[model samples]
Target: MPDAPAPAPVPLDRSAFAADAVTVAQALIGTTLLVDGVGGVVVETEAYDCEDPASHAFNGPTPRNAPMFGPIGHAYVYRSYGLHWCLNLVCDASQLGSAVLIRAIAPTEGIAIMRDRRGLEALRLLCAGPGRLAQALAVTGAMTGLPLDAPPFRLLPRTEAEPAIAVGPRIGLTRGVATPWRFGLAGSPFLSKPFR
Candidate 1:
């Protein structure tokens, strides 16, 4: 009989996620984010810190950002632009108001499922946008307030080359434009549209 394929490893440790913008962004560079789907969906992510004035939670707790304040490892999913669903991983227990906005992902598994969800022929477009990634990964408002350190969804380490990173203004923000907190793979097609 042929050998069975190995089961995908489970990543439950919370320390792999950092509490600061640079550390969070750097740590997520090559990690795989698994979301709910047929076999499961894998994604890459980015982060932002509370110290970042541009960050939504920078001004202290608000009704819209209370989730980020309640837990260290939770999903702070929010309805952005009155339509788009933006995903964020809540970080820092003491800070209680910092998170990393998952800006993009490079699809590694369940491409067909993603394609159907995104309704796009082009692979890049399937998960190129934040809102689209949520749709493709089956993440919705229901994902809000969910535990990030447990099942249904989680992040895995990547062995691939930690691509050269770059930082700049966060998207759709008026303040902290010059803070250069946004981080992404340099010259990668998977990266979001750069501010400049």
Candidate 2:
């Protein structure tokens, strides 16, 4: 694909983003995701459906997961290992507690600051992992429950290059490993390490 104009807002209405979990994951890739005071990063994410009991919000809304219960395109940041922060994009309007986990990102700009913030030496490793991407982009509990279109974080227009998608098991989830909810750029080295 040659250089082209940026895509218009992907109509992130309540219904658009509130689709099945896997669909949300595939749709996020190539979509520009921005972080305020930091910068933007293109999304490369994986979905975890609510049907899967292993999902964090599968049990329903709580203080930590309340953001997922909101309308589509909201940020849901959670703490992991009592240290790192992982970001989830809200979806499934009616269910009110479903989200797609942002497994990774391809840093589009601000590479210098992002690398420093993440303490990473290599560019590929900057946003290679879920927690690393969030930390590098300044995602935290404070950014949770925020709208994607507003400030702090934004999902910019999708680029012209459409990545071929491949689906597989969601990482870290043993119960639904066979569900094929994970989506990534086919043949792209940046795709998450295939679940073993």
Query: Could you list the CA RMSD of all candidates, in the order they appear?
Result: 3.1, 3.6
lDDT of each: 0.70, 0.73
Q: Which stretches of candidate 2 lie over 4 Å from their true place?
A: 1-15, 37-43, 194-196
**Native-structure RMSD, model 2:** 3.6
Model 2 Cα lDDT, one tens digit per residue, 104-144 = 77776788889889787787788877888887888888888
* Clash tally, candidates in order: 1, 3
Worst 10 residues of 2 by lDDT: 7-16
Q: Which stretches of candidate 1 lie over 4 Å from their true place?
A: 1-12, 37-46, 194-196
In Å, residue 116's CA in model 1 sits off its true spot by: 1.0
lDDT of 1 by residue, 1-196 (tens): 9899988866746665545546776667666777763222223345566677777777888878888777667888998878988888877765667777777787878889888877887877777668877787877877887887776677776556566677676666777766666777666676657535
